[model samples]
Target: MKIIAGLGNPGKEYEHTRHNMGFDVIDELARRWHVTLWKEDMKAEIGQTLVNGEKVLLVKPLTYMNNSGEAVGAIARYYKVDLDDIYIICDDLDLPPGKTRIRKKGASGGHNGIKSLIAHLGSENFNRFRIGVGHPQDGHTVVEHVLSRPYGEDIQKIEDAKIHTADSIESALKDGVDHAMNVFNPKRKG
Candidate 1:
């Protein structure tokens, strides 16, 4: 079994924010698989399905973005899932909007949600699927930038990226992280 955890803050207020990109991806997955993520467990909303013929657990942390690790860690422990069988999706400020990057494992790159995962799990040996939201323009505060909804062209780009990234995630679960990275990461642009 594999666990796919998408990190984001709870509440409708953050539904379309850049910080909620992860939640959007999770929603996309649930829709694509024709499953409902209304089940709550371990502080997360979950849906179950088969990905590449393997049982897959789709999770959206309900503990907010910063404390996402708590929910994911609990699920992982309860499922007795191996670190290698875990995948995480989140927004990345380092890359421009629309870019999607997949890594087998690495540092948090200054994302509090990712940092929390690294801390609670005590390991970075997992998958990270990052959707770019770009850095704040000029003097804009990081918080404000992430919480603000995208406008005009950026909105379309983010929407496209989300769909592509969701597909890439399915590919990763079907093949392997390396294959998904080779197929999608090379096409990423900042």
Candidate 2:
């Protein structure tokens, strides 16, 4: 089974925050697939479904961002899922808003959630679907920017990225990462 974990802090306070983009994308995916409800697990809010005929466990870790690995590891271990079959969706500040990137394997790039997962799992080789949230303007703290919400045009970009992120995950799960990368990495004009 494939475990798709969307990393973010749980609770209403963190909802709609920039750092919670991962959760946003997964919600979009579940909506598109018509998955009606998310069942609670020990460490995650999960939904079970088939994506392109493959069994998929959609997980939103309730362990918050820094400790996300605990929940992800538990689910993955119980399901006997390999690192390659795991996909993490999270926000990226390096890329401009509305952008999405898929990588088969990579370092955490300093994302706390990804770092914790790597630490617990003891591997950096896993699929990642990164949605761009963009960096703050000059003189702003990174933490403050990521925890804050977007506005105006930025909001539109984030919404678009969320939809595209879901599409990329579906593509990667169905057709493989190479095909998904080719189809999604390039700039697409609206």
lDDT of 2 by residue, 21-123 (tens): 9999889888888887789995899999998788998899999999999999888888889998999999998888878898888888988999999987889
Write out the backbone clash pairs for model 2: none
> What tens digits encode model 1's per-residue C-alpha lDDT throughout 1-190?
9999988888978988999998999899999998864698889998999866789999999999999899999999998999899999999999889988998899889999998999888898889999999999868899999988888788999999999999999888888889999998956378
Query: Which candidate gets the maximum TM-score versus the true structure?
Result: 1
Candidate 2: Cα lDDT at 26:
85
Angstrom error of the Cα, residue 61, model 2: value is: 0.5
Could you list the CA RMSD of all candidates, in the order they appear?
A: 1.9, 2.4
Model 2 CA deviation exceeding 4 Å by range: 187-190
Clashes of each: 0, 0
> Once all C-alphas are superposed, what RMSD does model 1 give against the true structure?
1.9
Worst 10 residues of 1 by lDDT: 181-190
Alpha-carbon shift of residue 37 in model 2 (angstroms): 3.0
User: Candidate 2: lDDT of 38?
Assistant: 83
lDDT of 2: 0.88
- Where is the poorest 10-residue window by lDDT in model 2? 137-146
